[model samples]
Target: MANIMAASMYMKIALVCMLVGTLLFVIGFSTVSWMVSSAYNRWEARGVWKVYSCGTSFCTYLSYGAWTYFGRNDYEHVRATQALECIGLIFALVSLLVLLLYLLVDSCRRRNSLIAFVVCVFAAVFFIVVGIAVFAIKLGYSYHVGWSMGFAIVGAIFMFVGGIMGILQLTCR
Candidate 1:
């Protein structure tokens, strides 16, 4: 009985961490400021330039002068960046769904829940890492990482920690 209670506590903590991480991921993914081009000149000064994924195929760039540009134009790097971001978002959502299912189904099999949570957490971490890596590599040369990237990184860390906690919970059983 005590073991089950301990597992339950761990599970609850993991769920809360995942929930907050998911929210942060969503916010980061939606924002246009993953990277901002630094200001260089007066007219050539790209003031507060920001880029954001619009879909798997395209992204939007907002210039310093309030001008917005949209188009993939067959840019492979841009497409890849967008795709990765989308994948990360999907993984995070799926993880959240699995955690919620574990919570909702009173008759849920413990073994199944354990496997599902582990897989979901790992998958989420993988995608989030890859996505952020691609984004950083592609833009790091020309732009500075922004708050959105920071949020995504922090979210990834939370998700990873939550996964570890979930795994520990299983062992406690």
Candidate 2:
């Protein structure tokens, strides 16, 4: 039992993060989808681009696939899942980037809105930077399995918080 737990630490952490991210994505998507659909139904509302939220919803699920793969701890599985995770990361990151663009475009109408935009930008950048730093250290210390997993857990936690914020904004707004 101890050996099993020891072997699956990374998997356990990854699963926890994935579950949290998935829940946030669902709430965020539902809120945004409802808002946009209602606006369209009203006919008085003009078209608004919301591709970022849409993309995030899709990629967030893919992250689950990656987490499953990573949990398996098979080299081939990890590689495949890592690729998917990276793609999902790209989509997730792009979603945040697009939100920034939307904020920039509409910056004239709202003063305080920029604050949320800035926070989102900061969160996204922090996640990306932490992920890169963790991966870099992992590469350098290839022999240190436990240490690398620790860094990965930190990165995953950052992503989880960032994702939750991304979703919360959709509903709150």
Best TM-score among the predictions, by candidate number: 1
Candidate 2, 118: how far from true, in Å? 16
Residue 162 shift from truth in candidate 1, angstroms? 1.3
| 72: Cα error in model 1, Å | 11
Instruction: Give the local distance difference test score of model 1.
Output: 0.66
Minimal lDDT window, size 10, model 1? 40-49
Model 1: per-residue Cα lDDT at residue 68: 31
Candidate 1 residues 1-173, lDDT tens each? Answer: 12324347777788888988888877776666676653432111111124333444544554323443343332445556667767777777777777766666666646787778778788878877887776667544656777777778788888888888878877887
In model 2, the runs with Cα more than 4 Å from the true position are: 1-74, 107-145
lDDT of each: 0.66, 0.36
Q: Model 2: per-residue lDDT, tens digit, 1-173?
A: 12313322333342344445434433332221211212212211101111112232242222222333225622343344344335444544554444334433444213344244335434543544443344334323222223223333444454555545544544545
